[model samples]
Target: MASRKPSTDDTTHKLKEDLHHLTQTIEDLVSATADDSRSNIKELRARAEKRLKETRDRLESRGERLYDEARDSVTHQVDACDRYVHDNPWTSVGLGAAAGIVIGMLIGRR
Candidate 1:
């Protein structure tokens, strides 16, 4: 048997849970007013901030990679279409005209 990979939705849900837990921890620390508790709160806050920054960096990196992938995919598709249009100009023109006529007829009926 093979292990299943976690989906993006699962990753997002885990991140949200981590953030919520961190927030609750911070809120709990806020209620502690003793001098010893102050030091503990400071350390906890620093660690929490570090974790948040790390999570943000991970999310940003994923977003950038996804954006690059989409841009490349679109560029490839557009290049393919451009080549096809150049190689078969008449066919492309005929297809465009037929599509326009269909759209015109549909609109005229409405």
Candidate 2:
């Protein structure tokens, strides 16, 4: 079976969950430090810092992936449009002229 790439919504949801987990971890660390004098503050701090670093790395990687996905999608669309225009030059020209005329009429009214 082929693995599927996650959609934008899925990625966004995962990021939100990661952020929430990070927030919870920090909160726990704070509460633990404040509540117990004998508690291992160093271990708690280390864990919180590790979580924060992991979340930051995940966010950075996801942002880069999102940027690359958007760029690729736009490039694909532009290529498809270029192909269509080349294949149907006259139709594309007519459509462009029609759109321009419509815009001109709308602007003239204003």
Candidate 3:
């Protein structure tokens, strides 16, 4: 059996979930220490808040870029495939048939 690789959507979802968890944890920490009077804890909390904001912004930016890149890659592949099929219809048909046969055999084996 072939192992499936993670898709871009799956990766993006995982990243979003991780960022949400991190944000929640940091918020909890900051709120839990809200009653503290220590200067060091206050400073640390402020820093954590800043870093979390920066991280969220960075992740959003990167996710957009990744999505754009993946879209372009798939578009390019599809255009190429279309061109190939137009250029060699018979070859494409033969290849498709061979693929179907292989898949059928694989399923039969199971």
Candidate 4:
């Protein structure tokens, strides 16, 4: 008996045939079970949607709380800075002018 050699074309043809057969099998299975799969997907979608909505609401409220905290912190800082500037107006004025000059120079360079 002569031994047969495996060719690339033959291998590719066999792979294509196998894939075609698998595709047909999958199509038949899906056709037979599509209703059940759709029902399950619907239930999962509803549950997932509800959970997502709840999570969104929670995150939105959390964001509001964080925004309030940030505003309070910023207001407190501005008040403290204002007090310091008022208490030491001369020093603050000198520092402010120096900072303004440096900023002006930087902007001019740009």
Each model's Cα RMSD: 4.4, 2.1, 9.8, 21.2
* Backbone clash pairs in model 3 (N, Cα, C under 3 Å; residues 3+ apart or in different chains), count: 0
- Per-model tally of clashing residue pairs: 0, 0, 0, 0
Off by over 4 Å in 4: 1-39, 105-110
lDDT minimum window of 10 residues, candidate 2: 35-44
For model 2, how big is the CA root-mean-square deviation? 2.1
Tens-place lDDT per residue, model 3, 1-110, is 99886687977797787677677767766775866768756766776677677777877877787888899999999999999999999999999999999999999999
For TM-score, candidate 3 versus 4, the one ahead is: 3
lDDT of 1 by residue, 8-48 (tens): 79878977876786676667566553446778878777766
Identify the candidate with maximal TM-score.
Answer: 2
Q: What is the C-alpha RMSD, rounded to one decimal, of candidate 3?
A: 9.8
Judge candidate 1 against the unseen true structure and give its global Cα lDDT, from 0 to 1: 0.80
lDDT by residue (1-110, candidate 4, tens digit) is 99885465865685566556555555555564566687765655555556556555655765676688789999999999999998999999999999999999999998
Q: How much does candidate 4 score in TM-score? A: 0.58
Question: Lowest lDDT 10-mer window, candidate 1?
Answer: 26-35
- TM-scores of all candidate predictions against the true structure: 0.71, 0.84, 0.60, 0.58
lDDT per residue (tens digit) for residues 1-110 in model 2: 99999987998899999999889888988888886755577778888899999999998998898899899999999999999999999999999999999999999998
Arranged by lDDT with the best first, the candidates are 2, 3, 1, 4
lDDT of 2 at 48: 89
* Residue 65 CA displacement from its true place in model 2, Å: 1.4
Query: Cα miss at 1, model 3 (Å)?
Result: 48
